[model samples]
Target: MHELAIMESALDLALGQARQGGAGRVRVIRLRIGTLSGVVPEALQFAFEALAPGTLAEGAQLAIEQVPACFWCAACAREFTSADLIAQCPDCRELSGDLRTGRELELTSLEID
Candidate 1:
């Protein structure tokens, strides 16, 4: 799965940062995953478990924060959480709006020892 590659890259980045900070090992990796990011959390978790063997992040906890989709409804003149991509304004049923968030897959922080 592509999540394996993604986890590999994330692990590499976290390991690099930990090494630069003179960390002996990583304790946790905090990730922010948006609902619209198209990333499967379970797949990512399995990939991390399989790939972290013998690495600095071995046994490290992967903490994922789920971000909901937020958008601005032009017709309603308000920002609200979207149920899906085609979500219209709940009040006015208008399809036009600006997506504000929920398209991110960011590695926020790493807790290393």
Candidate 2:
């Protein structure tokens, strides 16, 4: 699964940050995941379990903040959320505009000792 690779890279980044902060161990990792990020939470969690055992984040808990896919409709002059990949503006039915948020895979923070 690509989640394995994603989590591996994220864990490596966390480990680097932890080490930079002089952390002996990591307790938690806070992630901001968006609907459009194409990541499955269960799979990512499973990947974390498999990859964390031999690192500073061995016993860390992964805290995920799920963000909805949101978009701004210029035609309608409004913002909306959609579970669909192709979102039509509710009012104007336009399929174009600046995507306000979502599409995120950000590692927000890490709790360490």
Using lDDT as the measure, which candidate wins? Answer: 2
Model 2, 1-113: lDDT tens digits are 98999999999999999999999999999998998899998999999999999899998999988999898887777889988777898888889546777889989999999
TM-score of each candidate structure, all chains considered together = 0.93, 0.92
lDDT of 2 at 20: 100
Evaluate all candidate structures by whole-model CA lDDT and list the values in order. 0.88, 0.91
**Deviation in angstroms for 24 in model 1?**
0.4
Give one digit per residue, the lDDT tens place, for model 1 in 35-65: 9888899999999999888988999999999
Worst 10 residues of 2 by lDDT: 92-101
True-structure lDDT of candidate 2: 0.91
* lDDT of candidate model 1 versus the reference: 0.88
Count clashes in each candidate, considering only residues at least 3 apart in sequence or on different chains.
0, 0
Span of ten consecutive residues with least summed lDDT in model 1: 88-97
* Model 2 TM-score on a 0 to 1 scale: 0.92
**Model 1 misplaced stretches (Cα beyond 4 Å):** none
